[model samples]
Target: MGALETMMPPPKRARLNGVEIGYYEAGPREGVPIVLSHGFPELAFSWRHQIKALGDAGRWVIAPDQRGYGLSGKPGKVPDYDIDHLTGDMAALLDHLGVEKAVFCGHDWGGLVVWQMPLIHPGRVAGVIGLNTPFMPRGPSDPIAGMRARFGPDMYIVWFQNPDEPEAVLGADTTWTMDFFMRKPAAAPADPPPSASGSTFAFRDLLKMWDPSSDARERLLSPDELAVFADAFRDGGFFGPVSWYRNFTRNWERSATLPGRIDGIPCLMITAELDAVLPPSAAEHMPAFIGDLETKLVKGSGHWTQQEKPDEVNRLMLDWLDRRFPK
Candidate 1:
């Protein structure tokens, strides 16, 4: 057994949505399963802690290194990573798991996909738990256009739109890219005001210009854990992952016909106190849109809320499952 699978279910793969999806799953198959989706530049390994904990609690849980990530197959084109394809991948995975609906729990970009599950494939989603990412209505303009106007082109999301640029930067040194991102926030992380470009995230105006050893930093992953991510990215490169961002405009354009608000379904929004990009304030209006909603804040955690504070995140998630979708 590899170091990554020491506690969680064994890694498995499936062909779904015309792409290869690598996943890990465990626990009873009797109830509505919990499907965990990962975010940008991440693998299913990111949920190493939650999968074991949640599975042990008697809930069927599946975590996938979604398309263009980890062991998953990467389609070459950009539009292939659109919101429909993302949500569809999960729905198809549910079909493979022989279940109809799942309580979707996602962190970072995974959260965005889970939030869209209700809109794109409403029948497949039993519930939602957003770790850091929030459920917001489709904006009046194309999201990429809004980001460009508000944060200029340097903003990471906007920066991702350019073909080959992000891929090159991130692929330059896979280990360094993973190392740069997988860090615990500085002891005294300053919630700096947004830059002149109007971007809310100043702490993470990263990639193009980052100091690997500037601050006395602590890594979120142990050397073995870090190897799992670095090695995967080293092979996969960033094209597939970055392509997800390239589809913002495409996703927004297609969302016009979909339901903007999440009604009926139970929801939980867990915000990280130190996550500048997806801060607690970002989730402020979620309750208004989600009629049945609950919220929690992970004190002192940064963007990597689940990995940083596994116990708290697990407690909150398991508690919600017990109340909202118990066995």
Candidate 2:
């Protein structure tokens, strides 16, 4: 339990854009506005700790479930789930709140959204913060291509983009998939079994073995915490969330035309050291994409930094926001 754990409180829900976007708001309504965006397979409740901390600090905090996940609007069309729609949903959410410009922060896929928001609607962003994901200068290369170039044959993104396969595999057993993704890594087997290559295991199985120790698993999440995620995914389904993976090329093509670099918008990037999905390598050369950038590494944490290490995450966020948009 880090500093954020003690300061956080539960969030409230809202109905926006023809869908119920669960969100939590704190701080003074008249204070500076900070909008927090959630990543795939995550709800606005993910930022529960930060909302209370930031709000108590006298800064207005807004955390939304985003359009496709949780109670937010989930459209049927694949094309409808494009980056334009995703970013547009954020803009509409801001408009709904009558906010002119807000400090934007996000993690994982949410980080991608915050990074692009400043580009798509530069006028509406006061500053930006990205967790896990990094700023890659847009070019002819797509996200899949970048993943392939970086991870080689065993690329998760490439596997995820395979249309219905992932949805079928993960959707069929949501709990199994959740357990797999949330689990920590394990130690190597003492005696390598015959005909047992680590590569032979399914991604889900391998992820389950990530933290073989029951103690680590217990510390990863409580039954109640796991239930929170399970309920959301069970209701939201995997199709809409997986659709985000299918939009790699679409996001790249759209981002290619924007200016090569961001100017004047202060930025902060917090990388989780133990996040299996998003390793430190992912953030390489991020400073090349933003004018003013600050980077921090949270040791002994996984992809769910906000949930796993709330206090540290909150402190870093508050420190950065205080510097960029002082009250």
Winning candidate number (TM-score): 1
TM agreement with the true structure for every prediction? 0.94, 0.84
- Clash list (residue pairs), candidate 2: 3-311, 4-310, 4-311, 27-55, 184-210, 184-211, 185-210, 185-211, 186-210
Model 2 CA RMSD to the hidden true structure, in angstroms: 4.6
TM-score, cand. 2 vs. native:
0.84
The TM-score that candidate 1 achieves is: 0.94
lDDT of 1 by residue, 1-327 (tens): 556767557779999989889899888777888899888778888888888898788878889989999888989999899998999999999888788888999888999999999999998888999999999788999888887877666677887888897788788887888888898887645544455566544323555456776745678888788888888988988899989988888988999999979997899999999886688889998877898999999998998988899999999999999998767
Off by over 4 Å in 1: 187-209
Candidate 1 global Cα RMSD: 2.3
Per-residue lDDT tens digits for candidate 2, residues 1-327, read 432234344545566555556566777887559998888677777787788788888989988777777767787767767778877777777787888888889988898888888888888888888888787677666777876565443345566677677667676656656765665433321221212232222353344344444434434556566666677787778778888878888878877678777888888989988776676768878877778989999877777888778899999999988877888
RMSD of each: 2.3, 4.6
Name the weakest run of 10 consecutive residues (lDDT summed) in model 1: 200-209
